[model samples]
Target: MTRATVQRWAAFSDDPGGGNPAGVVLGADDLDETGMQRIAADVGYAETAFVMGSGRERGIRYFSPVAEVPFCGHATVASAIALAGELGDGPFAFDTPVGRVDIETRTDAGVRTAAFTSVEPWIEELPDATLGALLALIGLGPGDLDPRHPPRLAFAGNRHPLLVLADLGAFDSLTFDPGEARTLMDAEGWPATIIVLHEHGAGRWEARNIFPVGVIAEDPATGAAAAATGGYLRAIGAVTPPARVLIEQGRHVGRPGLLTVDIPESGGITVSGTAVPIG
Candidate 1:
């Protein structure tokens, strides 16, 4: 197989060293699933996005080192920014495994930002047994959960278990066994665990994403989880409609990425972030 050109970008942060690093492969129509998986493993990022076709009919796929995921938010943002750099800033539509995703890219001065509207999101109550197992894996008790936001499984393109903590101290001191996390995530079919802490001001949150199933112990910035979180907040009536929320992630791990989530009265959640090329 011919080697594909892979572009690396740090999503949700303008700095190359900050945020999540995602590999973007354009013109991957010729690559098979096994080939894409191999390239993703070689790239060694949490996820790699493969874009095929063109224009409004573009097809995209996301692959982790271990497996192929239905959708990946950071990779989607990275791919959109990478494409914008090549094709000029504009809107792009992608046909993903979950559904259609629309991404808009804009360049102001030298900064490039990409925002993608996710598929219609939904939330489901997390089963007691599953919640107990997850808490055990993370070494947290039910008491550790924040009463403000109840636990629930939220889904945009992929599913994530949302856990809100009461204090910043708990959010900053997160630790979990990778083996146990992966086991529980696989059994529950969860892509990651989205742990969040509400900040002092309105529409502000601190987040940490644990992604053991993807062979990533923690993700500096996770777009999918952010989208799911917005959906969860709306579903639980924690936040009113037509609100914009800011998510601060990767601080504990030191990457420090910023994600903006826009929640409308209904329909898809929009997650926006800046992506810069990583040398």
Candidate 2:
């Protein structure tokens, strides 16, 4: 296999310390699943994107440190920003396992912000037992969860269990064993669960979710999760239809980034963020 030029970028914020960090393999035409998984783990970021080809029909895949993920939002944002830097402003298509995503960056005025239309986003209410088990395994109780937003499985490019909390303080005092959650989620064919930190003060939130027993830090920003959360809010009627909202993530980790989610009345959610090269 030829060497692939892997570039790292911090997504959501113009500052490196303001968002989630991901690795982007600009050239990955010949890499396989094993190679991608290895690369993702090696990068050690939450997620990494591998561009397998070129043009509007390029093949793209995302991987987490522990396993191959169906889709990853932060990595996609990073990859889009990186590509925009080299290829200039234009639309790019990524054929992911979930579906094809049309990506474009805004650069007419200044640094471009990348936006991806999720692959047919939808929501599925989780079972009561499953929700209870998840809450118990994660050391959170029913009260810790947000009653306004029920637990549901939301899909953007991929699927994630959306667990909403009312405030940042509740989110701040939370913990979940990744290994245990992974085992449960894997059995259900889901990669991981997302903890949606909700704060109404500024339509901004900081998110933190733990896996079973591996990576210990919080995910500064999660576009996929954000997309799904937006969908869930619409499904539960928490947010009015056609709501477009902005989410601020990674503040607690000191790498805060912004996430913009658009919930349409008739289609998939759109997630967006700005990505900058990590110096």
Candidate 3:
């Protein structure tokens, strides 16, 4: 069996210590599912991206330390930047498990950024019982919820429960049971993370992604969650169409990251961020 080389990247931030770290394997056409999972686990990142082809169109798979996910935005961004370094910056089409994703890569001011258009997004109301359970799991009460934005299950590529808090202090003091949260997420088929948001201004939000991927209790940055947030805001009429939203995340974890989301009147949401090689 051939061993595939893995590249490490920090997504959503230019600094190596900032954004979420991801493992990218280029030319992984020979690797099997077990091999990919082993590599992901060994890399110890939230997710790892495996590319099966080396053309304008490619087959991509995302795997966490424990299991394979339908899609992973941070890994995709990391993989795109890695590919751009070798193949030159341009557009690449990915055939993910959820559906087709088109990612565009560009260089501005000597910084490379990749933007991926998510699959058609939608939102569903979170059940009353589920909402209560979620609140309890996070040590947050019903009163802490923002009245303006109701709890809902948002989906871009993966499902995430969107819970908007009324105060930023809640985020500063946020905590959750990783074991319980993982069980709930697995049972609910939410392969990504639980997104907690606090709107600081119009089209701007501070987000915390609760992701228990192996030993990692939280995700410093989650592009999928950011995309889902955009869809949730649009579906709930919280934001107008043709809007650009900013998501600030990873601060609580000490790895500050930023995500730019572009919401059109319809169709997929575009999530953009820059990734830098991690030393």
Best by TM-score: 3
Q: Which tens-of-lDDT digit does each residue in 157-256 have in candidate 1?
A: 8999888877777667768888877878888777545555555467789888887644578889999999999899899998889999999999877899
Which window of ten consecutive residues has the lowest lDDT sum in model 2?
209-218
Q: In model 1, where is the ten-residue run with the lowest total lDDT?
A: 191-200
lDDT of each residue in 80-148, candidate 3, tens digit only: 888899899999989999999999999999999999999999999899988988999899999999999
Ranking by lDDT: 3, 1, 2
The lDDT of model 2 is 0.77
lDDT of 2 at 279: 78
> For model 1, which pairs clash?
none
* lDDT at residue 114 of model 1 (Cα atoms): 92
Steric clash pairs (candidate 3): none
Alpha-carbon deviation at 34 in model 3, angstroms: 0.6
Q: Give the TM-score of each candidate.
A: 0.96, 0.91, 0.98
Instruction: Give me the candidate number with maximum lDDT.
Output: 3
lDDT of 2 by residue, 36-147 (tens): 8888888888888998776655788888888888888888888887888878877988888888888888784687899988877778888999788877875778887777
